[model samples]
Target chain A: MRDLELNMVFDPSEVLRPSSFQDAVETLDSSDSKIVAGNTSLYSLARKGRLENIKKLVDISKLGISYIKEAESQTSEEKKILVGAGTTFQEITSSSLINGRPEYAGLKEALNKSPPQIRNVATIGGSICSAVSFYDLPIVLFALGTTLKFFSKKEGEHLITIDSFFQNPALYGKSLLIECQFSSSPNSASSFVKLCRRMSGYAVAMTAARIKLDRTSREIDDIRLVIGAMTKTPQRLNQVEEELRHKEPSIETITRMCEKSADLVHDIIPSVHASTAYKKRVLPILLREAITTAVERATER
Target chain B: MLNETRIKVRFILNGESRNIECMAADTLFDTLRDSLGTMSVKQGCDFGGCGVCSVLLDGRPVYSCLMPTWKVEGSKIETLEGLKGKELMNLDAIQQAFATNFAQQCGYCTPAMILNAKALLERNPNPSVDQIKDALSGVLCRCTGYMPIVEAVMQAAMMRRKKTQV
Candidate 1:
């Protein structure tokens, strides 16, 4: 029999319902708390005794937050897609907005690169909240310049830029996440690339790039690039984007920018993966391929 | 010090209402097989790495092995047995296709596979091979590979189309 003394499973509060986050929080407040969503990754942790620290679980399955909403941007005339924290990667990839949106190539591509089982059960909220480097969605969200709306028990509701969101994920201690919103840009093309050992596993390296090129001028109007599985968290390469903002989307300029990215990655990320040496050697190659693919996609439409 | 005790949770399982008093630590998988005697939902891997313990909660497919039974109160639960006699199964399209296509060798993985496929076809009546692969990718089948399983789904789709025409 399992030892109940060392690893105690606390009794849950019966009043909590599936439809309320507040209720879920109340349950967590009563004892040592852990939140359950999808549980694909969490269960493994529990079974392995990694979560021996946790005694109470806050179930978030019925929080009524699993949704994909397209709302008009208040400042910009563009429309933004808001994905609830409970929205699974599978739901996002298969959603009509992602598959049908010509400009959302990066989002669709990132979803494709993620593993099958993880895609099915891994939620956008849980993945982002974990802040793991290998997660596929963060790079895309950061590249799209997304915003996260966090709900904290102490501070109530607060909004943070996707870049700043990763800077510190510990802000929301007891409260939960609501959703992430990213306004769709006009005349944009996106691409996502992953260097993984197989079809379904954590990424060794990954990149999500969104590029908008002026057809008449052939100059890059706007660009965003985010890299994951390289550091403490997914990073948005703002310096590289600044370098390529007005330049023509040519081979020489692209290669230079990619090289700069490799240097930045090398300096920022320590203890890279087992494939780190090989990844550093081939960073530019993958970056160039991703950029080229994004450019091609943008030009097609 | 915090006091731990059992919590009472009630939900509908396979069209019957059940009230299960369990510890918050007890997962839906454990409650079903041990407490409720619904052994159809096997525990291939309790860690959720294997999708063998998949069940339908409120009509969506989820791995029961990881979900807490206490969290499922007031929610509707359906297992492989629920699908066995449903009108959709009686059409016997997919199950019949599986039988005809030699989709099972060991047969241990069939229930999970069927449930996964059922969930997919419900969402998308006719999914491409790529989409089918995506849908069932969470499930692991150590026997017959996936080609025969894929062919069975395709044949089932064709049969559904045939029935629609008549």
Candidate 2:
């Protein structure tokens, strides 16, 4: 079946290049119209005959949304980074603004998950909208508390939290994702860990953790723990976060909580590559590593 | 019957401007191998998983198999064909190093490996062992165990550096 799909030819009828957001939205409103950016996933899907219904291809690469800049935050105490949807993983990984910053360490690691070839063309917007469970960026972005700005014919323009967006991505179908913004706070850092059979291979289990430490108390003030590649969608381990909050971070306590949380995980999607038992066994180790690195970075800041 | 729509795509290939009409869904891999006859861009995995179809797009290495033909409009593309020397005896530094170091076995992945190394050398004149590994990690080479390829890239970087000093 896979070989047959690979041999199939994909030929679309028309390709539309929209220069403005309004024009893109209008084109997307038409039936059987789909947006193409990077063309990494779209081309593969088309070759596999998954996009047979897609007749009109709207090339949104020229929509003028490829950018990464610092935006003024609502509060003076916080700093926000706005990343255009069209920005590729390579761009994000090499950005001086994102690199060397402890707050964005997890994002940089996630962006480096893919090799140079894929990273050079795969855009962040496409990665998020695709909503593939095993993708590294979505899991890290969720832990970083990212918010998406999308445009639809009905809503015009609105912002949705990354958490909510992943919960029901189909609800925002036919909408144009403009950009994503995440706030960076002082004494905060993030880390991502993935266990793959080989380098750059699909993750059997992965975890992303972000920690915000109280400057005075040096305690874990707030934390976000997200685990992926073991389920249909990345899930947040709220119980573990609640257990660690306002407490001094230690290897023993974190290991204990993560181990307990791993046992509580149910409904794990089995894979031919990795068994459910093996994934469950390693989930706690990945969680401990991610949290440990995040805590270490937060303290260093 | 399938609806067919072809449009003219203009790009600079091998330092020469080219304009070709192709289907809306045609990938850069198809345009290069079928339309332009640049056979260096091998077609391995139609998807982006395999890097045998790698090429330099505007000085950055990308998977040509995953790039749409329309996306390369007005951009610069370079493949192994463009890196060859004018004469048969003379070869590009990377190519010469690969030949001397026995970098290739079956030679199927040589073009992509050399092209990826070329891009890395152009960006960083002197790359470390880890840097070379990171650059060539995308291209899968079943033979030679990759040590020879890494040595070849390192040697090529030195050769280029010596040439500039002279």
Leading candidate by TM-score = 2
Chain B TM-scores, listed for every candidate in order, come to 0.87, 0.97
Score residue A182 of candidate 1 by CA lDDT: 83
lDDT of 1 by residue, A128-159 (tens): 88777787778888888889887765566678
Please list the residue runs of candidate 1 whose C-alpha ends up more than 4 Å from where it truly belongs after superposition.
A1-31, A60-64, A72-77, A112-121, A267-273, B1-4, B85-91
**DockQ-derived CAPRI band for the predicted complex in model 1:** acceptable
In model 2, which runs have C-alpha deviations exceeding 4 angstroms?
A1-9, A73-76, B84-86
Candidate 2 chain A, run of 10 with poorest lDDT: A1-10
Q: Candidate 1: lDDT over CA atoms?
A: 0.75
* Candidate 2 lDDT for residue B55: 95
Best by DockQ: 2
